[model samples]
Target: MSAKNAGSKPNKPADVIETGRLWQRPGFLIRRLNQIHISLFYESCKDFGITPVQYGVLTTLREHPNLDQTSLCAEVGVDRTTMADVLHRLEDRGLVKRKPSPTDGRIKIASITPRGLKVTEDMYEAMREAQIRFLSPLTPQDRATFVRMMLQLVEGNNQYGRTLLKHFD
Candidate 1:
């Protein structure tokens, strides 16, 4: 099917459809790319003892400091339970500081600690390398178009995700 027609439901009878054609599906390709990206991210970041999600949280907090936990969860595109667990781990490692919000006693505000900032800064090159490697197979023009299209897809279907991305910047 053409790219524009790919999203439509198949008109063919399921009994006669070939399952092997799954390889050509966009969802399959995206899932495979996610697997590759995770592998490459870990291979490059293994020395730092941080997972991809942890790094994302650290970087997000670094950019937008003192975000309440709920807001942080939205910004990081994760559920509240996951956010709490991540924050607990970061707080235990002293990579993040969390405290009760001044105005809202029940809310916890999170800030990246000095060590977290340093770690994020130090991991910048490795992260950049991992991203470069992920897109290494694509030509320069293809890479740009691929990224634009991916962003378009994400924005078009953002609400379908379990957690909606909330961008503050």
Candidate 2:
């Protein structure tokens, strides 16, 4: 039978099935959802005068003080150049400081200033609320399960996560 006739019929050979348009594809929907989620988070961070990545860096530094640039880069999943740029911006804003390691001149340590901590603290509630809103559709248990599955998808293969990070870097 012709392809058009095959599609119109209910019982057709599997080989006669046609590929759907991109908009109707499951992958496209998932990608669009991710974009929406990122846009929402980015917009929320704008009111605080920082990008999502910048906020992540500040929060990471707060948790791990005096980390060297290389270590900080790894922790934040940013490359050396991008991390340096972010650090420079933060330093210019007087929110972070980079100092030569006392014992190792080759290494530069990064630390969050009081102002940085204060800014992050002020945004903590907003970040929490944003997360709640993002996950509002899911029950507590469903949210947990969703998070677990997402982590697995992102981190299951080391190369997969690294590949995704490369785009951001």
Candidate 3:
């Protein structure tokens, strides 16, 4: 409701949200929600000194050992250039090692080091805490519903993005 309709009482959270009309804008809402999630993640996992992209790369490598750079980039849903930078940073930190693929010889392969696996394992709780905090405002049912809706949206629109995400199948 607008201030005129608000009846001079303090504006409740719902009223303020209604006034903004941001709820109707899906892109704006998605970006705003991403910012909130990133903030919560940074606050909870700052000690780990890792960003979500870095963690994704690490975890992808952990799951699929010796994946070539091109495949890893596709799986991680990032451009090759950005993936290269993340890989370089991880390599410099001694968390991952990159070498030529044994089969192809020319294709660069990446695998997480023991240190990387240890760090990723240790970060599980902190990241889980961040996820919990991000969804804390939602009821248990709403949380499940929200996640289901998100998956539907992503799966329906995956073809539009620059990077094609890998399917588990």
Candidate 4:
């Protein structure tokens, strides 16, 4: 039987299936939402003279100082080349420092500078305000729940991010 005609007959309710457009697909919805969120976030951060990815890298380094380049790349969800470019820019700006790891000659550690921390502090309120506006549909409790759900979606599914990374790589 042809693939299209194979399921032409509808029997029991359990065996019946409905077909829909790509816009109705869950994966498409998730991807579209992510695109919208990232675009808005990047635009909001532009006033701070930093892209969203750069802000993320800075935040990651601030939270986990002295992380090596490889680790930072993973944490920031960026490729090796892009991470290198970001590190170079941040280093040039005196926002981050790269030093050879004392224990390993092959590894270089990244640490956020005081200037970077100060810049983050200055932008913190603005960023928070933008986030609030973005999530205005959600109440305070709903906002917290939404964030928790989003984290769970990203971190809970191992295959989700790994599969997405393949396209970028």
Best by TM-score: 1
Clashes of 3: 0
Q: lDDT winner between 1 and 3, please give it.
A: 3
lDDT of 1: 0.88
Global Cα RMSD, each model = 4.7, 6.5, 5.9, 7.0
Model 4 lDDT on a 0 to 1 scale = 0.76
Error of 1 at 105 (Å): 0.9
What lDDT tens digits, residue by residue, belong to model 2 across residues 88-163?
A: 9999998899999999999899999999999999988877777777888999999999988766655655464432
Best by lDDT: 3
lDDT of 3 at 137: 98
TM per candidate comes to 0.86, 0.74, 0.85, 0.74
TM-score of 1: 0.86
Please provide the root mean square deviation of candidate 4 (C-alpha atoms, Å).
7.0
Residue 30, candidate 3: alpha-carbon lDDT: 92
> Rank by lDDT, descending?
3, 1, 2, 4
For candidate 4, the TM-score is: 0.74
Candidate 2 has a TM-score of 0.74
Over 4 Å off in model 2, which ranges?
A: 1-31, 161-169
- Preferred candidate (lDDT higher): 3 or 4: 3
Worst 10 contiguous positions by lDDT, candidate 2: 160-169
Every candidate's lDDT: 0.88, 0.78, 0.88, 0.76
